[model samples]
Target: MEFDPALFIDLFARTFTFWWVILPAIFLGLIVGAIPGFSAANTIIILLPMTLAMDPEVGLIFMVALYASSRMGAGIPAILVNIPGTAGAAATPLDGYPMTKQGRGQQALAISFVSSVFGGLLATIITLLAMPWLSQVAFYLHSVEMIVIMLFGISLIATIAARDTLKGLIAGFFGLMIGYIGADVVYETPRGTFGFLELYDKVPLIPALVGLFAVSEAFFVIEGESILSKRGKEAMQKAGWAATIEGVKIALSKWWHIIWTSMIGLVIGVVPGAGAAIAAFVAYQQSRAFSKTPELYGTGHVEGLIAPESANNGVTSGTLVPLLVIGIPGGATAAIMLVVLQYHGVTMGPDLFMESPELAYGPFAAMAVTYFIMIFTILPLARYMSRITVVSTIYMSPIIISFTLVGAFVPRQYMFDMYLALVFGVIGYVARKTGYHTAAILIGVILGPLLETYFLRALKMSEGDIMVIFSKDLANVLWVGLVISLCIPYAMQRWRAWKAAA
Candidate 1:
């Protein structure tokens, strides 16, 4: 498990030689990620035959490259059109879409691309250096600790609710109620499915995400001629490459923010079942809590955009740690990776590291190389991509609804999901028109089931004692941190008021 400099160098060189494989995967990943409901996991599943035909090492490198770039690509639509291509990008539009509305779409894309690439790259390097110790993270975090972590993400509902507490909470809790539609974890009893078998497996996330964000936005945008306002269109028309350059400069200026938020993603990714959605929200919440200008968040603030984009990409690296070290998949993509690796006869866990150290560590090296190449490959496109905002909503709305409906249908191939997406779209439109935050609702849907599962597990372990959540040392420490984080914003607000009076 010790870091071998020579081995790493060789791995890096070998990975570079696969630029042919890596480049294509990166491009494909970007395309897939830009389209809602298409993710690295499903894409890889479609290409399973091709991957199985390749050398195990080459196939793995391709998957790693695609995973990293896709994480970056999901942010593109989120920044330009307020559509999150993946759940990981859910937090992105809080600030990114606002920037797009203000005609700063190019800068937003530039900032997103730069932060995502560097965040993922730094995280990969850390993964390589700390592989031995980092692998133990999953083992250390049990259901109790995971529940706390889920709460950290769930707390984002409060953050979103700050603008209009009652409506936000109503939306969040309604989403939670929707999330509880499937069978109960322990008894398999249905809660709110209305007896449809499709609801047995819980609400399909792709349809829900597309319904709430893209489809709803499509419905709203039709009322306007363009997605941008008069000033926004003028600003965009006047914008040049300078906007992209300014974005990169702004992102680089917040290097420290990128580093820490990415670390949050890395840690969260280490736990099995923790996905990019949770990481992005937790990072955003923490970032806002510690910021000097919390009021500026949700208003196209650079840090708000940076926090989620960077953190989600950082998750790409963390998701692999458990798969490689403990033979457990951390997320959906990792689960698909496990299938590929198993088919290739690559044994996971510490034994693989001991037997085939090169194979064990090679994916990380390839991931780092993928991220490095992405800066050059994807960065310049930000200028052109920003122009997407200028397209007339007349054409854009139909295109969006069409693609999102297809996206909703692709994941489960259920015609019912397409209809369900329309249902959620109407719900989203109502929420938007009523001043409720869609993100809060989505958060509750995404994290509520996870919270319930972990909470149940912890209670079962403690013989149904509710106090078991505060029993473990690490859990207790995390609870204290959560309290401090929640209090920081209010404390800072009071400090500002006192300073103004003095």
Candidate 2:
């Protein structure tokens, strides 16, 4: 019942003692993060069982380190190749690629790394401080309110659809429909499984994530001899330690920039459903609006690069707040972490801290140590990392596909998963070729069941009255917030257009 300084000290001491575990994960993350399409979530899913096998502390530390660096690694391709490794890094290229074109590719990479470390570190501390206050939020948000929160995340699908709401919504709903494949929770009747026993359970997440993100991306990666642009090749040749040092100076000098943008990431990350992609874009937009030199933003600016990188990594910490404090995963990566925790029999939420302090606090502590390791590890390798773009895709593609396909078979050890992965890969490839958003579909598959489960629980408690969603006071408040958020943007856009016409 009392705060024991020794326990807190022991947790960090234990984490620090696991240097062997933390260091490898950071580098592993860097490798995957640099390659477009190899998201950390899929990688973790592929290797989920291995993590499950390790001691809980070691397993969690490994995942935390990889997840954090994965966000950092994505910035590499965005700056060098004009292609973001993960959608979270999508905002990085707005200014990063221009810097690369200006022969400042290494500098951009350095700034990205510094911003990420600073944001991740600061957000981790903030999360540690805020955990107690934030945990109380879970008490008020029961199933009814949680359903609204799920909708809030689903709403982000439209924004990521990239000017194609119809396609995004279709993808989201389709994933949701697929989520109902297993037998209904209330009754024993299978909802959508044509006949297979596999359908009697549920769709395996690992195969679905790998097939859609990793395998589909490999198909695209092979189309090129190299992943780099001609100019990117030139930039890589000249990068070295000096350039990385300069980046550290640039990022550290703008301490306020990193702090504020990272806070933006923290706020959005806490909200259910909003991931780094939204956080990065929001931070970028805010930075531009408040800039004294807004005109310089899209033209290879350090501040521009800093904002998004900081925010996305800040999101890394923010996502965990909900998962640890409320048992709700805020995004896909957080969901993967949830699976690992559940597999290991670690219950989340406030009580987790009291019951399993080591498990509850270990992830945050590991995050801090990881950032410490990342700064030194990634900085020296800026030169080496930049050169990766030059590696021919001929070599890279097969390695990526073969490894990921293997990963698809890891979770359940079922051949059905391999087939399922290929099917999702084809679907992902089609979605990529068309305008449909892969994230929307993935989110649908991941969160659809969660949403349905909560909705049904709320309805059942209220004797099947759909209006139960608005019965609770917190639910009413959430509904109001959701409606305003959905309507205000369209209304504001129309108002601006009308004024211009007048």
Over 110-132, each residue of candidate 2 has an lDDT whose tens digit, in order, gives 88989999999999878877777
Please report how far candidate 2 places residue 459 from its true position, in Å: 1.3
What TM-score number comes out for model 1?
Answer: 0.95
Best by TM-score: 1
For residues 333-446, write the lDDT of model 1, one tens digit per residue.
Answer: 888888888998888989999899878998899999999988999888888888889999989999999989999999889999999999999988988888888887887788
Local distance difference test values of all predictions, in order: 0.88, 0.78
Worst 10 residues of 1 by lDDT: 153-162
Highest lDDT against the true fold, candidate:
1
Q: What is the C-alpha RMSD of each candidate to the true structure, in Å?
A: 2.0, 5.6
Kindly report which residue stretches of model 1 are placed more than 4 angstroms away from their true locations once superposed.
Answer: 160-162, 480-502
Residue 19 of model 1 has an lDDT of 97
Off by over 4 Å in 2: 1-21, 28-112, 221-225, 233-363, 393-396, 488-502
